[model samples]
Target: MPVLSRFALLMLFCLSLVLVGGNSNELRAESRPNVLFIAVDDLRPELGCYGASHIQSPHIDQLAASGLLFNRAYCQQAVCSPSRTSLMTGLRPDSTKVYDLDTHFRKTVPDVVTLTQQFMKHGYKSIGMGKIYHGSLNDKASWDAYPTVRGRGYQLPETLAGIRERTKGLDVKKMNWRQRSKLTRGPATEMADVPDKQYRDGAIAEQAIKSLRELKQNQQPFFLAVGFLKPHLPFVAPQKYWDLYDRRQIKLAENRFPPENAPKFALTNWGELRNYSDMPAKGDLTDEQQLQLRHGYYACVSFTDANIGKVLDELQRLELDENTIVILWGDHGWKLGEHNGWCKHTNFENDTRVPLIIRAPGMQAQGKTSEALVEFVDIYPTLCDLAGLPLPAHLEGTSFKPLLSNPQRPWKPAAFSQYPRGRVMGYSMKTDRYRYTEWQDRKSGKVVDRELYDHRQDGAENDNIAGQPDQKRVVKQLSAQLKKNWKGAVVPD
Candidate 1:
């Protein structure tokens, strides 16, 4: 054995050790679980998992089976921008100052980091497509790859022609989105004999599937946010989904009248639905129309469910399911003729309660349902805790990560929600047995209207007993608790 031969062999061994060290670093980075954040617009807790036997939500039901389903989850606001802003920023509507669709959260909190942005700061590749933010108000800085992919709302040529005819003389370019929407809106529901890709939700799912493949190739942990637009408005879905339900079997809301002895200001005109061509301008929806709308909503839910199944299938095929934290949440809830309302402008149970299903890797609470009162604002901190990241300083909500391990554990005492009605703000607090709302004047801060619905007696919220003589004590207690707001409602360590 020569001395020079031994020196050459030693040098090769040292170089090989350096290469293994670099590879180990890469492997450590990839060890972090990926996120599949799915957002569905205008979805309520009306599915098989939620005890709605009629709705066909197989894919969502499957996701519920694999995750801890929050049965009592409520959104901060019952609208798109505000609810999403609150959830993404981990701040309430008051903190973000985003109460309407037109106002962007960045306008008020310019330096605040969003949910995905927090993950991005921690070496996660954030990618978003479709309606993550409301309409065109997406934050480009939050996503490494953010693309807008949407198709026509109406697939029928006749519907398009009708819209053009309705807006023929008006200058659409000069109008804002709401004004343009009112003028050009067609029928409330459409069932087209087209493929799933023909609709925007289907296209979004396809893009998500493709993105999952690309992320797998890169071998980097990603935060993929896919938003689905359906069961929202103009309830247009593929013909096959519509065929899944029989119109005769579709039942309208049993309590179609307004809540007894409730304030007039508490109910919305539901102008959002009246803008549709088929809807009446100033009248109650006909029984036939109500049934049709319910049927349309169910079909759209099924359609969105199928699209979700596609993405989930792709994730499993890529073997990313085991290492991905899959979360499906609706931006807010929608009312289908509940309390004689058609939209989500009121702070009722139907409008504020949303569907939230989260399936994380190695969670022991599989197929469990938690009745814990959770709000959308808690989502940001929960994801952070689940991924082993520190909670942001600006987070106004507590993490519910503990509930994933012990689904039946006693959690937050109450969940808070709010809705703005002109100059009034209706702040609602839902405890285990009751929902109390105080409609206060925004400028003067005077509590003008009050509502108290006892869930033990009236689960449908068909009666308001705020002014009842026997319920005085109940109202007083709930009012005191409402004053505590989100801060006092935070879960204990």
Candidate 2:
């Protein structure tokens, strides 16, 4: 053959390769599934799938069986604002400078796209209902179209009309010794009868089902975020849920009575205990009352589970289950009297560890469990990867694609969380088996709280063996890692 003919043949071969690669890319993009983003507030890993002995969460368990359940997932911050901010923006709490409930991540990453924004940019219709973000005051702009009437999963029926009023009468400011004593212990009320249609959980379910139905008819894919507000404080639920679990069956948590094994300074940062009038503070709530409160919490969880079931049922009914990616994540873990703490704020597992489940259509293997150390910040990149969307340049989290596909795949060795004050030296660190926190008192030098726990032995974090001679080596190694991996060292303006 002549040289010219040989060159022509080479060009043709190269062109064919290019066409094949391009076609493959198109196929992957076309096959990407719609995302059903489910966010729950203040939930711990108390689901049946996560091996909770008592609490019933059949809906979530079923979802987990059909998806990937992350066992050792940690939030960037053990509070709502920072956790949600990090999750939404794919930035760490320190990097975003959103350390409190009052501060939003917008100040740091003003032009940054949220998970919803990214999905919308890629031709997906984004809709959010209920408590997706941390909203104590109001977030009118958070959703695309927040209904004038409370969206589903956020209302109480007329039958329980006085529930809100009862919640309002709870006073936290009266933390005087007498008040704490008077409030401790006793049964308040049974789950009692309440109209199902009027409850917030039911409302959220109705709205989500409606949205799923509408989305099924549309040609465009959607990113529908259904947020459930429950298992949080003032754990109120329809009486039916409360009756499901007998109070005697409620198992006592390791450290439920009050603040123990915690520094006084650490306890001071717990504003929720002081702020939420409906919640019990230290020395308040007798053992029986504590049980009642806990009963309410568990019942609310079941109530939330039922609501989730409704949305899921709609997805199947609409035949959208095959093409949708479902993800259920709690903003952060709540402290149900763990480590002598009552709520999330500390870096303890009960506070920082949240429940994260992802079902990526046919991409994920059913009934898989991943123990990979993942952070809430990783949510952004994982979703982008699943959708074949380019991850924004500013995202700080790595996609857990490998781990999601194969649950036993090894990944990050540690997770990070941060807590900052307006002017204090603040606190931040990397955590694994050891929790290394550095607290700075404006006027004083940095004080380090290095707690080392053999998770194999101390899953409850009952003992803080920070200064133990035998654990010094482990603490030193973790300290070095903490400094090396500290992503949010500088405070954002």
Candidate 3:
């Protein structure tokens, strides 16, 4: 054998070793961070972080202070199913064809890959515990483990679950005329003297905390979505939470009526609030009743915040915070007697705008506030980008990774939201200082009504300027923008 041949063989062996070592290093550096996705139902921006200093939201405030809070975040629709469908699928409500609560997205687009399934495809274990989807529509295919979001939303003891049991019997038809006439109406707000675990949300928090502790032992990365059903209907919580707020100090809604000159169908029927047994059969709530409702909502918020704090505290205790990405988002805003409306289902600012906070590791965008216009759909691509996963081509939203590092980056000029009422669909666009909407007939696709609210002066959208002659030009411009190319298909320009 020649010495030159032996030396060549040795060099070849060294090159192979270097290649394997480099590949190993690359894989180690590219390990995706775990995701802690927390969702709150019907949460408005009435938090200390969102400039509501009087609200008791210390937990959410601290989370915002540790992350990048989007000042202008809008949901595709103001309702639960539609909004959650759009956010989870990375598609607009129109695209998903989920304009209402009854219809599932699969009925329209069966092959759609949801945000959770996207991560799961890349070897991550996805676990959904609460109201991540609307009702019992949680896609079983989208998770390694998905507990139905309704019945066991919490595992409260038999005693604490008594109030919920009563609500189950709210069907008026089931009661005889005598039963109905003799029915006793309880207040919409209830401060039960029960332990935290007595309510469903408290039970959800317990399960999530347990998950965090167990996840530390798993080798695979995780995407845990914990949904908190609070400040929602019934406004029920533990008595301790109700004690957190003073009913006297709670402020009633300023604009208790719909905006002046607004379209007739602009507000919902407020049927959700009306369905409660304590609510009167007709007319606006009394001043005292309004205050009680507001106080109940605040107490529910405080209860939710405390639960979130407990889960987040557990994460830190388990040392998961360092390598995990935490995202807190509300399904959509709620109008608590604002504009004479109760539940969400309108394009109004109080109904459409939502709270979104993302805290990525490495502290790139930590403790910052970004006023950039963003939408719920952006969560899909942004998570993909952060985790170094491939973005699906069908996603309608653009990744907001750039803005995560520099909050003032050039982002989307505006965010869009829409809601459906009967045969009419209201298309809304939110820009720097304006919220413009156009309601079109679903059958003919013809514009029926237009509304423009100048947020510069009235952020609460107290007045509709769309009908004013002086603001006609502004309305026209925004209308044109709304009807412009929405990713390819025109919204009937």
Please provide TM-scores, in order, for all candidate models, with all chains considered together: 0.93, 0.83, 0.88
Query: Would you list the C-alpha lDDT of every candidate in the order shown?
Result: 0.89, 0.71, 0.83
Where model 2 places Cα greater than 4 Å from the true spot, the runs are 1-30, 136-143, 148-192, 256-262, 268-282, 421-432, 441-445, 488-493
Candidates 1 and 3: which is better by lDDT?
1
Which regions of candidate 1 fall more than 4 Å away from where they truly are?
1-28, 168-174
Model 3: which residue pairs collide? none
Q: Order candidates by lDDT, high to low.
A: 1, 3, 2
Q: Report the CA-based lDDT of candidate 3 relative to the real structure.
A: 0.83
Total backbone clashes of candidate 3, pairs 3 or more residues apart or in separate chains: 0
* lDDT at position 381, candidate 1: 89
Judge candidate 3 at residue 177 and give its lDDT.
Answer: 44
What is the per-residue lDDT of model 1 for residues 128-189, given as tens digits with 9 covering 90 to 100? 99898998688888899987676778999999998898888888989998888788789999
The residue-level lDDT of candidate 2 at 224 comes to 88
TM-score of 2: 0.83
If both were scored by lDDT, which would come out higher, candidate 1 or candidate 2? 1
